[model samples]
Target: MSKHFLRPPGAVAEADFLGRCIRCGKCALACPYRAIRVAGLLDGLEIMGTPVILARKSPCYLCLKCVPVCPSGALESRVKKREQVRMGTARLNRKECLNWQGTFCRSCYDHCPLFNEAITMDGELRPVVNEKKCVGCGICEHVCPADPAAIIVTPRGAG
Candidate 1:
């Protein structure tokens, strides 16, 4: 066996797996919390249409959003945390969310003292990110009204 194994059983093959992804955007679509973002055709060859590049922006929490929609099996279903970690840190579960249904909830957005730090608003009145401003704080995760918390934080990982 190779002593330097690339991924643990639950680890994500971010580069290869993402490269193989068909750009279906299903992972981004299925995410009730909208945590995973499927890129467009021109973002970059490395990340175009694949799951959000954890490095260019934020990191992924353990929400497993991209894992479920990978029809091509490009994205692995399981990965040990020790095996890989991506760049971006704020992640949302969506399964336990109050915002997915369009309810009036802003616990996560409200408690974020650094309004422009980790989260921001779009013209549509939803939270958009100033990626450069984010500090990867877990305050949004702590204040989320969702049971599992629609949003959470992930540790910095090797993108």
Candidate 2:
């Protein structure tokens, strides 16, 4: 299973985030969507109490509330607009997509926060992810009807 998960929006580089985060849970508290949660002990001591987001379960709405509330610089306050977030990038598994399989489906495209810019339907009426425009908010993955999801968000900095 993939261990990759997202940090709160505006999170700095991983190494700095791990060190600077004080585990105050302020970011989580600020989130109206409850999209932020503290990592538990099972997540490993290094990350325990650090904020995490399981996009499929609950994706960030890019409200930017978490950024200003962070006492630590873990989640940068500089991100004032939705377009500035770089949480990760969405990648589509064409083989798993219903549209690509000849059935009609546009859940991902319909649910994308960026709308037409982030996800668009091709000439075949299949969803195509615009990596450059995608904020990796995981809205598409969350709304996907396919089992295992036809698309997923890969956290920023994760290869």
Q: Superposing all C-alpha atoms, what RMSD in Å does each candidate have to the true structure?
A: 13.6, 1.1
Ten contiguous residues minimizing lDDT sum, candidate 1: 1-10
Which candidate gets the maximum lDDT versus the true structure?
2
Look at candidate 1 and tell me the lDDT of residue 124: 49
TM-score of each: 0.39, 0.97
The true-versus-predicted C-alpha distance at residue 41 of model 1, in Å, is 46
Estimate, for each residue in 9-85, the C-alpha lDDT of model 1 and write its tens digit: 12244556545667777776765555456665565555565555332122233455556566776655543342232
Candidate 2 lDDT over residue span 1-159, tens digit each: 136688888999889999999999999999999999899999888899999999889988888899999998988888999999999999999999989998889899888889999999988789998889988888888999999888999999886
The TM-score of candidate 1 is 0.39
Query: Candidate 2: deviation at residue 155, Å?
Result: 0.3
Q: Flag regions of model 1 displaced more than 4 Å.
A: 1-88, 93-96
Any runs in candidate 2 off by more than 4 Å, and if so which? Answer: none
lDDT of each: 0.50, 0.90
